[model samples]
Target: MNQETKQIFSLRKFKTGTHSALLAKYGIVLATTAALMGAGAVSADEVTTPQTQPTTEVVAPATDQTSANVGTPAQEQSAVTSDIPTSVPADTTQDQAVTAVDNAQTTLKDNVSTAKDTGVVVKEGDTQEVVINNGNAAEKTSEVLTDLNQQDKAVKEATEKQAANQKAYEETSAEHERVVKEGQEHLEQSTAEVYQLIDQAKKTGLLVTETTTDQTPEYKDTKGLTGDELRTDMAENLELYQAAIKAGIALQDKSVADLKAALALYQANQKAYTQGNTALKDAKSSGVAELEGADGRQGQVIDLAKKNDVTIDVKHETVTPNYTDVKGLTGDALLKAINDNIALYTQAVVDSVAKQDGSTKDAQAKLDAYLKLLADYQAGKGTQSGIKWAENTTVEAGTAQRMTGNEPAVSWGNLRTAAADAIQSLDRNQNTDATFDHIFKINGSGTVIIKNTTNGDVTLKISNIQAWTAENTYLAVWGAKDGGIAWGVFATTHGTVTGGAGEGATGGNVGATGAILAMVKSYDYEVSTSNAVSTVTFNDIDNNQTVTLNGLDGAKLVKGRNVTQSGNSYSAGAGDVSQASGGVIDSNGIQFNLADAKTVTFSGSHFLPGYINTSIVAGIFGVASEVPKEPKKPNLEVQNVDVTVPEAPEAPKPISVAVQKATVTAPDAPEAPAPVEVSVHYYKMTTTPEEPTPTPTTPVQKAAVLPETGEAGSILSVIGGVLLSGLGIVGVRKRKED
Candidate 1:
């Protein structure tokens, strides 16, 4: 093997040796790749379903190194790209192949770093295969980069959704507040209107006193409330207020109408009373004028006798008519006294003329005129006074007209006895002849007659007296119908008379030759203010028949013990005779029967009529109905909005990427390249293990035990061992090549 032969032989030996070493290195690479692929291969069953939808993004390799903080989408893509090599160098020299292998190893480490930075969790007991092939390595790196970008997109979408939900919640809450405020205002206004109506009714006196307080509704305060609670309470309160307004207005209208009606009735009654009072006054004035004319005529008769020179003595000796003195008299007393004096004077003139020697024609004519005047004065029709004279008659039946505002003609006690005798005579059933005397009859304005035929001394007496005048004053009158009985007392305010002539009897001093000597004697009576009126009584000795007088003065009548007649009956122990035999007495009076000689009495009082008048006024004026008050407003409770604050999308739950190792062969390999283990990072989007909900009685449950994936520390140890073994093989091959 000279120089040429030796050179050729040396080169051949080196090529053979280099080929064997390369093949041995390839074998070692294949074996290591197989082991890494086997460790990284994870079954689909082991992987859990993703909690969220997976998003994909294709990431192109970057030209420049990027920041480690993968916070933004662009930053994340750049960071992942910085970890991957652009291309694999050709393995021509031993050092170059070693450098290429070193670059591949560095790429793998960078990818793992990027994975950690991007929040890709590498579960324990999981192996990753890093392919050193020129074409497939970039593809694997792009998968990891894509996962980072997809995670960022998911986070952005989640944040936008959360913002939209929050805005919607705010809008709903605002609308609810507006509705509540408006509703409350409406309720308050309605309540105020109702109160106004109530106040108006009271001020106008239209409110009914009896039910105003009880019917009035109370007000309620609503101070604190919010949201739907306030709205609902306001709605209910509004309804109540509206109802109160309606009812209050209606009540006011009714009260107004009632008041109008009552006022109208009161006015009508008052007008009627006024007219009646006027008529009463006119009638009283006419009686006074007629009585005055009678006095003038009596004077003329006396003067005419004197002018004729008839030798008629002014004083005649004869029984003079009973006459009361006319002095310091007023009202009905003065009128009666004057009339009586005139009648007595006229009688004196007649007696004196009869005793004279001759009576002149003028004297006779004047005397007759005086007689007619006297008769006219005695009857109630001429004087317009409430007095009437009934001449004595033999007939057993007669009628008398009822007269008002009249005084009694005779002593009431004596008259009662006479009436009792007359009534009792009817019960005797006797046939003896009887004389019926005309007695004074008195009552309200109407005619009432008494007819009886009997044998006993039948003396009839009827006395019903009343004063028709204004509220505070009254007029009363009384006079005898005829001069039949003797020795009667006539008392008046002016004076009194005690002794009088009997019926058809005359007495006086008379001279001889038929000449009048002295005036006739008059009745004797005691003058006293206290004995002005006689005591009136009714004594029934037989205890039989009942006497009922109806339509008496309501103010004067009083109910005695056991009185049974309606309308202010004063009889004691009387039977119920409201419906009497003659007719129903629809006015104030008394009913009584003579039981065991019982006597009914009367007493005067002035206060009762005034009280009755007051009652009438009250009935006319008081008319109204109750006024209702405002209804209560409801109290609303605070209602806080149940706002579910949307969580800030949880940052897309840190998309979990499964770093799986896969083997791929290079299509452009000069020889069979070692099977490359590529770590393809993808977003599995698995959820973190959640803690189970705890029951009321049990303690909080811990996070569910995740499926056993080896611990992180052990996985790192396996990776370290695999890396060391690969490095050792490269170093040995390099040492041999050197």
Candidate 2:
């Protein structure tokens, strides 16, 4: 120690400690108290627990005796040994304190003696180093704690921002997935439908390719394609609809054409069959069962040939016995009547033959000249036999001329004039003779006179008569027709003929007796005596009875009936023509069967009141003309289609996909946390010095190990502050010094 420092330290002990009372002898330790005061986290309210603590319990013995004298300063003084003092005394020399007194004082300063808050108090005996250092420690700890809290706040904000970003990312990602999924599903369904269309087109022969691949990529990606491409895609799906309509039209056309062809074919076959059937039913056959219509009249005779007992219409081979006419003096006999001697002429021959000669060759030649006449006779003759007599009578052969407007028979004068005119056309040979008396009386079958007129010859044969169908015609000058051997001597005589040519001669040449010659050359016929009663029924396919037509010319019809007319002819009514309707027999003398009013019924067609259908009219034409009608078209309903087919491919592709990353703002670096400002306020309930309690709660910063010049700047900054203060103080001091 320096000599003055030793003196100063000695005197500081006595002044700051009661030990200084005894340290009147020695006082060097007192200055060390200031160093102790600067030690740790001691504050104004801190209960400073000294690092070098002394035992306070031992001091309790002293304080208990002090409380016994409670209200006195002298009593508190007694609690401390007389060697200690309450405050430092300024005067006693520091080199004089007793050694034992300094020890006691030092012990009191290091340990807590009472529990009271004094806010920072430094006594001379206190450890200043320790107090100051403790305060510095507390301040440093507070700063460290503040830094930790600020970091924690920053971390919490960063965590919140990360969570929110995560939540948003999850929601956005989910929505994206949903939209993509639904769109994809729609595309897949559309593709399937298109595939069906493709298959249909292929099966219907519309597709170009015949493989399943035609259906692949059926759904059109319609992104950018247009115009023709769009139309093609639509067509692929609906071609079947178009095809159905086309097929319907084709079928209708074909049906109409086929029906037209069928109608034509049926008509041709009907006409050919009718002609063959008619020729079959009109041959004269004996004992033939005749079919009859309701009206009475013998049907046209037919020969039914039997093939295995089944009756069929006979052809030419199915003949029955019939009589036919034969000419006796048709050629040779007529010429002989002209070339013979006059004595040979006979009146009978003259009447019937017009003239006669006793020559056979000339008679035969004349008859042959009139071949047409023979044909007329043969047609109604049935069959001809040997001719016994022949004649060429010159009687009138014309219609009884009508008076017009349906008047009665022609006058007898006209008939006579016609007869005379025909007689003039005879041969003019002198050997022959002919007269009006040649007109033979007719009975039932042919022209015959029972008594002779000139030669007195009875029972004679006659020639054929001439008459036609007329209203008042002479009816062929005979009542009936017959062939075969008839009654009487041969009608070979004209009216009368004197002997001219040969007599009783039978030679190829002319007979000398002309009258005998004419007699021998004539067609043989007979007069009959049967009553010509009409018996009958006609072709009524319903009846199988014969209709015998006698000479019904005079038969009168019943009343209330009329005959209808058709074309150039007249048709019979269902009932007989009657006088009540101003008509007798039918104009053609046909009798109707009035019974049951014979009917011609029809099926679904209606005939006009007085008009008949063609089919019905033709039935009485004794013929049929059944042409077929047009064929009917088939009637059918349209049908719905059922089909399964693949679809066609799409026209153009259309799809787009894109992805981009989210550019999130860095979660705005957690904002700087707000600064901490801890305010320290001080208050007290009461303050008393009686128990001298010391407390320290709030800490202050001071002591820090000086860094190796890193904190020198801060130190220098503190020094500058101190320099500014020191300059002001120096200015005051210099002014005072001045």
- The candidate scoring highest on lDDT is 1
lDDT of each: 0.28, 0.23
User: What is the TM-score of candidate 2?
Assistant: 0.18
lDDT by residue for model 1 (319-417), tens = 344556434443344444445455454444444333331223334433433343344444421211111122321322123332231323223223322
All candidates' TM-scores? 0.20, 0.18
Steric overlap count per candidate: 19, 149
lDDT of 2 by residue, 107-215 (tens): 3332211100211121222121211122222222222122222222222223333333333334433443454344334433444444443343334333222212111
Report the number of the highest-TM-score candidate: 1
lDDT of 1: 0.28
RMSD of 2: 38.2
How far does residue 660 in candidate 2 sit from its true spot (Å)? Answer: 28
